[model samples]
Target: MGWGGGRVLRDRNVVFYLSGVVVSGFGSSAMSLAAGVWTKSLTGSDSLAALTTFCVWAPILLGPVIGTLADRARRRPLLIWTNLGMAMVLLPLLAVHSSDQIWILFAVLTVYGISSVLLDAAEAALVATVVPETLRGDFNGLRMTANEGMKLVAPLLGALLFVQFGGTAVALLDAVTFVLAAMAFTLIRVSEPAPRPAKAQKWSAQVAEGIRCLRHQPALWRLVLAGAATMGVAGLNGASVYAVVDAGLHRPPAFAGVLYAVQGIGSVVIGLFSGALLRRMPERGFAAAGIMLFALGVALRVVPSAPVVLIASAMIGAGLPCVLIAAMTAVQRETPGDLLGRVAATANTLLFAPNAVALVAGAGLLALVGHDVLLLVAGAAAATAAIGCLLGSGTRAPAAAPALGGSVRVEDGGAEGSETAHDSR
Candidate 1:
């Protein structure tokens, strides 16, 4: 495809970018589901399977330091190399056979987690660089759709593949997707500056700046905090899915894929409408609504019916992405281009680190608490966060808020559109 000089066809960068996301997201989602199943099959421990997800998320703790790497390099090349590196890393997973080799799966997933850190930071920065400001909301919404849409299908495919073949088959498939995604990335072109001068700032200072940047932006800070709360509980909620299936619904482990697909359907629906929602509802309100929906969904899951579980999955699928996409779009709009990488990373660390902790804690706590109890706790927390966001937001509607990347600028006026968010990507 042509990479330059037209309106429709020339938007190849976005196309390539989304295409890569679709392919890689499918593989990643499949592998993520299969890893847990593989672990359960290898060892009868549910906690051990949840640990596989924990390994995949733990690397986000290093996001602040790792995110700076993106700003220090041309984003396009960084993205290309990172995708390729992830592909190479997944190759090691093919060695797993017996339960003893479970460590290999964890190790590979840990590496994948690190790769994800780079990808999120770079991709955020790159989008700011390549996409028109006006189009970000739609692009981000669509990206979420592609990602969650894969979650709907990939998990089933992975589970079936594992049932028929093995974890090695799933691993090989994931590795291939990584390669294909890298190739897709390489085909897109963008104009980027040389790396900022080394003397521009010390590395430690840069990392600190990223955190400080968010602190100074109240809207972004509040949004991110809400997201953190949501994810923190979401981790527990997610950790309960397998239990909900095995103990609550009395379904086999593979049935979890069916629920995931249901959730993906909800996500895709919300993603399609998200752009319009952003226009009517402020990012904060949109996120708050999502939080509430997710909480209610979790609460419904405690009903112990398969149909109710499916409904809960869709509620979760719809709700999680709203908070995520809203927070991400806010970060992109609020931070300066130079600090976008670090700021995005910092936000991710803040938002996702809690998820990692919750996952680990949930895994351990499952020994003591029932899945229904955990779901109740998660729902309460999310509902509380949602209410807090609404009550604290005061009377100002989100529609009155200024567009982040557009002509209307928001100043520190504490409301939207009053401040001009700097962007020199």
Candidate 2:
């Protein structure tokens, strides 16, 4: 089709959605960097600094339930309201006078976290509705690239703002971005296809349906497990910040910020080449490689030196995007459009539940075995995931060619079974 003929960008709805996301992502990244640094500075406790990361990810563990609500309701309204609500929450941070008000910061972060769950689920469902199947991979890649690009600049900018002005100033900027994003969303008029009558049931029934839908998908389950393992490792890595400082490094604060920026750079690099790579390799293969690389990188943190750890951090960052891209692409390709929101949510929950566990565990573990042991655990988990992927190759399959207007069937072990297919627009 031509640019104006049934293409994704030609769909005014998608254009509006993408526009809003790009704007809001800029603010979100800024908030993340500012909050992390501010909280660390305020508490003078690495455990508390890690809480910022925990708060940001905590809601994702509840993503399936949030996604179900999105699927059952009008997604556009949810998207618009969530963004506005998030902006309002940032207002409280503007008034913080001292580090003692850390609870207030946590509260604001909690609100932001819930808003993120809603926004992400709505966006995923909306994209499936607006974009054509043929372009889903490219569209998703584009979205990922835009978000990473914003991240690349937001941290450095936020750091500068923090140094020059304060966290309050950075918070205000975040609020402004959310307001603009909400306004942009308001201008879009997209008619979400009504839920199928059969698909519309009691809330409990719908939730169960989502659960059942995923219960039998072996490949998806494996992917979820791998994602969770990675998150756990990431949690350990976050906890290692204090250890880095403890290892005789001066200005650990500054070094930590630089490490985060480096990771963002790695994400941007992977985003640039993801589309081509996806076409060249199977998703499972990419995931296995990423996991292996991540494992190796984390293992290097066993070294007690600052430079070695810094180099290891870069390697871990570089490997992460590959894993993320591979997993997300698999989900988009395998799930039926109608169940996309719920499935995405479920997958996200699996991905993040470990993060919560990891945070608490990492803190305790750090006190006991120190940073070296923590890194070793993370590396071992990644290695296990890699092995699992390698052994499960028989169950994993490439994305099928898009079928128009109906479900698709696959023969597993020569047994033909029909499964619902998500229509990509």
Best lDDT among the predictions, by candidate number: 1
Tens-digit per-residue lDDT, 135-234, candidate 2: 5554565566668778778777888998899899989988888887778667665545666555447877776677777666777677667777887878
TM-score of 1: 0.83
Using all chains and alpha carbons, the TM-scores for the candidates as numbered come to: 0.83, 0.79
Tens-digit per-residue lDDT, 1-425, candidate 1: 11111221235555676778888888988899899999999988998998988788788898899888877887778877877888788888788888898998899888888888878888887776655554455667777777777776887799999999999999899888888887877776544667767666788998888889989887778888889999999889878889999999999998987887788799888877676677566788888999999999988899979988898899998998788878887888767888888889888899888987887788888989999898898899999988776665432243332223333322232211111111100
Each prediction's whole-model lDDT (CA)? 0.77, 0.68
Candidate 2's C-alpha runs over 4 A off are 1-19, 36-54, 92-105, 159-168, 184-191, 197-202, 242-253, 303-311, 393-425
Worst 10 residues of 2 by lDDT: 416-425
